[model samples]
Target: MQKLHKLLRMGDLAAFVGIVDDGGFAEAARRRGMSASTLSRSVTRLEEQLKVTLLRRTTRSIEITSEGAAVLAEAREILNRSETLKEIATSGQAPAGPLRVNAPVPFVLHVLAPRLAEFHANYPAIQLSIDMTDTLVDLIGSHADVAIRLGRLQDSEMLHRPIGRTAWKLVAAPDYLDRKGWPEALADLARLEQVRFAAPDHINTLRFIGMADPLEIPASVTANNGEAVRQLVLRGLGVARFSDFMIADDIRAGRLVELFSGQLDAEPLEISALYLTRVSGLRRLGVFLDWLDAIQVG
Candidate 1:
């Protein structure tokens, strides 16, 4: 037991996890505000203690071996267990730690930004690192404790909790509609230029409630970010289909006009909070999820 204690250190395991999570010693050190050499030494010591070559380091990159992957999985479990132990020790105190979250830009701006103050007030000790990107990010690789995803989730090993749903709204700025005549019939969309979402799931065709055939629309501009597309539409550039949570304020304020409001037959996008199954019991995560559940963005 004494030999094992001498060989293994929790700090070393944490450094190893941090190195892999950030993809490089320099990056992990920079993110943690530590020296890269210190992180490199910790990884070396961990490798020596474990008696396996966990990582193959190159000048520009570090590649994880199969053994490294296995170790990383165990390391994450151990770290999460340690965090749980801490929470257990201080049952009455507020949970605290860094909580990294990955989410889309529009959701971050429209939905989360407003409620953040309240969340911070509730858990003031919690440090939040929010990565706002329209593209899908790997939860482990990005080092995100939680990820807010939209649409039908693909097959994943991570655990997910369905938060709510949001439907797409076809909208255009009043000035744009005035300049380009309002689309009366579905066929009129052919003449209109649209600001489209540049995602794999985004389709060029539209399906209406009563229509037998799907209508294909012309895409004049395509952006990966939802906010960018909304901005383009607001500037009288073209028509756009945005999620209801995003356009609710704009529609109410008459900044944008909703076209075919209740006539479209489309599946509502599923909003889910995804996380590693190991960290599901963590108090900090639970608090955030509870807050999310209360908001119910749909």
Candidate 2:
């Protein structure tokens, strides 16, 4: 409205967005084919108009102020909507420039992070910006090109393509299993050591194939994150369960052992690659989704 116009007047929204997204006036200017001083002035004008500081200046890094972070998210949303409008007006065209993606932390760390080199090598023109978190992201609100979602999905405007699936892999480091021994049966958990995160719902107990009841396993140590749990297992702490996606590499490398040799069922998890529209897919988004679909784990 009037205040928004006042806040963003004169300077293009793209300038401020470029500065925030690239993390500095210099990088933004470099990318936009403009001088750093120009982008600096653009940001300064924006701050003056908005009456708030957006960034903390330093030689090493430019940190976003709290207000700046909030505004940055909004600015990305605005830019995204503007892009969508332009695409609709012209018909969806060839994709270029940055392609923002959001995915769970574990997926990013284990699956996406390791293979990023291949992605870049294949599609060097598409700049990949990744947001790694377990939380679900609103595609339009976050201005993300795509999102990798796991488990049951709710009805939404976004189109989801089934990308991959993960099943439970009860894993332990070779040394740990050798020393502490593996949980031979579901009932053996009362005496075996286990590592788990504090996620009450996921690790409250272990569910097995053809088991009517969930078995509550006592944990030797509880960490706060999936990576932590994975690390503890690698460090020979205890036998713990992981989604095959999270422990695939380790299991492949013989760093960890999948416990259920012939006892468990492979109930793979349904993972989807989500995007806003299907009628006219962005070329880069389609390319990335195909690349993602080929990722092997469990």
Candidate 3:
């Protein structure tokens, strides 16, 4: 029988796989928050122990040998099984270890960030790594433990739980509307200056509940981020659509005014937490999801 314990180190296998997945030792080290030399040493040790030339390295790049490709496949399986074992071990234990979370910028700033301090206080052992961006991310490829998504979710094998919803409103600053005059009909929207959310697939139209055709509007200004669009509208630039969570206080304080409330019937954006089923039994994820459920989000 093979001496499994003495055959090779699990950490060395992981490092080799990381080096290949990240495309190089330096990048793997950077993403893993370790030094490049350490990863290089791990791969070197792995190669020596296996008696196989895993990678052919040049000054500029690396080429993986056939042996390396075979080893990589096995290493991925072993590492994944190791993670599943960890999940099983911690299923009933106190919530601990690292949790990677992904969310959009607006939700991160307006909803999640405010509650982070209290969450840390409650579960001091749980480490958090949060990545904030508006663009969608591949959860498994990005190694995210959970992703908080807005709007409709695409069809996927990942499991999701609804967190809450936020109403969308057509809004503008008081001074801007006062200067341009209030819109009397849906047709008036096309004539008004508008601040638009900048995206490649962004539509320059609004779809109402009972409308047959979407109403097209002109974009006076464009911003890639929701917060930037909010700022533009606040500065009396033009009328823009905003989620209630971003401007509820401003609406109540009269800094911004909601327009065509009776006419606009845009559906509320649904908030949800997405994760892989493999991690569904983890206590730390469970604790975090429970906290998300308890918190009130606009």
Candidate 4:
């Protein structure tokens, strides 16, 4: 055990990582300006220490074994943490670390996609890892730095900062309306073919403004992705309630027509940036939240 402990040193692990990253011993050695024989030996030592075969080698090419692939993932995380630690120590004023974010698919597709370049330009030092999904995730349990959520949130220990809201737009393709006829009221929505977005967390519900009760309707088709739902809507498949931001271009282009504008305001789709209580104190989180708060959702 002690021998194994001595062999799994940071330097040896780093050397092992380089081998996998560069794809082969000779290439990694060339990049690092080290002897190929030295790197090969380091990997050999790592394999022995772990008591697993990490590589399959012949005269010409080598492939990583299953065990090697597993270790490679862990090694990369270690290296990333090491890099973050070094950056944090050297650059105190600049927020430099991996910022893992989770956000709804609709927001990611319509809102965040266009402004990512600007965000990167502003925070070039901070590494962003954005996970797009509609399903609700535990921010603390998932080790995510921030989660951009829409609609109401259940009481939780995480800190929430209001960012923006999504204004719901009831819309359909012009062709669809011509074929199925325009929905004059919320009651008419049920008669038209509906493009449904079903996810574990998203309720099959739409609440309009000035309506006493939310409309409950069954959908003709279901889709998991917001982009897919938009496409489905554009194809004249059915009428679907969409965030105004997602359909703004279509509406302006005369491709889609908004219906029931005077009849309903969607139950507030409040957008907020949720983060762990512990992470709220971190400057990296603060920097990201500040940026989020400044976002003007069009």
Candidate 5:
């Protein structure tokens, strides 16, 4: 029983599921980062231990036997229950694992960075690795422990906790507004020079509160970097739409002024802390989520 338990690691079960999911040894091997022969050997070893043929292989395809199908279902259930048990067991212990996290560049700099010292002081045993980028990462494939995401999520498999909210604001340097004059209505936006952020191609079609319908703003300048946009706005070049958190300090310091404060829609973007359901219940992740929720940033 001890030997049998030693052989049944999660990686082996994952490989088995991969093979069954991909419908062939080669595809499963690719997904699992192993060669087809290696995956076949592992499966063969597993079958030998159980004294049962799990797969019927042909030149063109491979199929799970009735027994194999039953085993697969049981394996999945066992893995789920095992993970749950591990989470519960570790919840009361000090967090002492490597945690890989991802978030947008602006959010990391403005919101998270300021609070890292406190988190580190509280949980010195946990190691943190953060990737700051605008691109969404595949949490499972990337092995990310956690991610901070804005807006609605299309993937339903991830467990999400709402952390906070931020409103999008049209902002410009006080000096720039002094020269160009503030626009009275949405129609005036077309006449003014604007800086736009790097967004999906379809974003241009969506209408903001002031606009009657979708209207494309003249991209007098376009930047993939959020910091560059903020700098340009600070230099009195043009008005840019930015999340409130990004320009909060500037607004407070009188470096930038909010445009159309009352007339704009003031849509609040929902910020969420997301992780795979499998990873969400881990001790380190749970603590971080609680910490994130406790933080109050403007």
Candidate 6:
């Protein structure tokens, strides 16, 4: 047991992580700047020391057995904690590691991208990697430090902080309104041409205001992407529901006009930043969260 304990050191933990990340011994060895034979021997030694077969290896490929997967997960957690300790000991000021973030596509390009330069300038030692997608990502599984989510959060395990609110507006281009007239009531929405915002499987619902109840408008044009729906609206195809932040520029330029504004509710969609509560107070994560709060969006 003592020999096994000594063998399962930091280097073995790193090797276990590399195998899971790279998907094979050859790939993991390549990433670690070692030969494939060397990596295989190291893993074999680890299994022997533990007296457990952790991986199922064949001539063509290697797969982590159930035991191996559990071990790998524990190893990753240990490595992360160890690295955090090292950072705490070495760096006394500012964040100085990779910050992985996930955010909705439009928000990243339209909102976060513009402010990144300033963040980079302030924390020059920190490196930022952003994954932009509207799809919901598992923060722990993806190793993401932060995520910017729109609307209400359903994950009770996560820590959520409200950043801002986005109003949902029913808008139409001038030409479309000129042709189809205007929708005066909830019933009018059914009669008018509509463009549906089709989000991915998990995020495929739309909410509206007024009429003593919510209305679910059928789609004349259904798209999986928000940008696609926006383009169709720009072309004067139909009236669509969009976030206020998204159509702010068009409304200001008079390209799009809001319909039935008086009937709509004032509670805008709540936007929040989400992360694992345990890691929310980390130095690097806090720095980025503070930067996000300072941003002013209309």
TM-score of each: 0.93, 0.69, 0.83, 0.64, 0.69, 0.79
Candidate achieving higher TM-score, 1 or 2 = 1
Off by over 4 Å in 2: 1-95, 140-143, 277-281
Q: Which residue pairs collide in model 3, if any?
A: none
Highest TM-score model number:
1
Worst 10 residues of 5 by lDDT: 200-209
TM-score winner, 2 or 6 = 6
How would you encode candidate 1's per-residue C-alpha lDDT over 216-256 as one tens digit per residue? 77777887778888999999888877789999999999999
Runs in model 6 deviating more than 4 A are 1-6, 9-11, 21-42, 57-63, 184-188, 200-218, 265-267, 277-281, 296-298
> Candidate 5: TM-score?
0.69
**For residues 1-298, what per-residue lDDT tens digits would candidate 3 score against the true structure?**
1332257788988888878877788788999999989988998998888888999987767789998888887776677667767878876666788898999898888888888999999999899999988888877556688999988888556688889998888888989878888887777877778888886233335777689987777778998988888899999888887778888888999999888885666778888899864545566888899899899675
Clashing pairs in 5: none
Using lDDT as the yardstick, the better of models 4 and 6 is 4
lDDT of 4 by residue, 81-199 (tens): 65556655765567766788999777887788888898889888789888887777776434467888877778655678888776778788989888877776678887787788766
The clash numbers for all candidates, in the given order, read 0, 0, 0, 2, 0, 0
Report lDDT (CA) for all predictions: 0.84, 0.74, 0.81, 0.75, 0.76, 0.74
Highest lDDT against the true fold, candidate: 1
lDDT of 3: 0.81
Where is model 3 more than 4 Å wrong at Cα?
1-6, 48-77, 84-93, 200-204, 296-298
Q: Kindly report which residue pairs in candidate 6 clash with one another.
A: none
User: Tens digit of lDDT per residue, candidate 2, span 12-109?
Assistant: 56787777667678877886798988888878887887788888889767888988877776675665556656556644444456788988789889
Least well predicted 10-residue stretch by lDDT in candidate 3: 199-208
Worst lDDT run of 10 residues, candidate 1, spans 1-10
Is candidate 1 or 4 superior in lDDT? 1
Per-residue C-alpha lDDT of model 5 across residues 1-298, encoded as one tens digit per residue: 3244455766666667678877789887775678999888878877887778889999889989987887787666666566667767877778767687899888998899988999999999889999888877776544566888877778766788888888777778888767877767767766667776667443223256655766556666777778777888899878877778999989999999887775555457788888865545567777888899889654
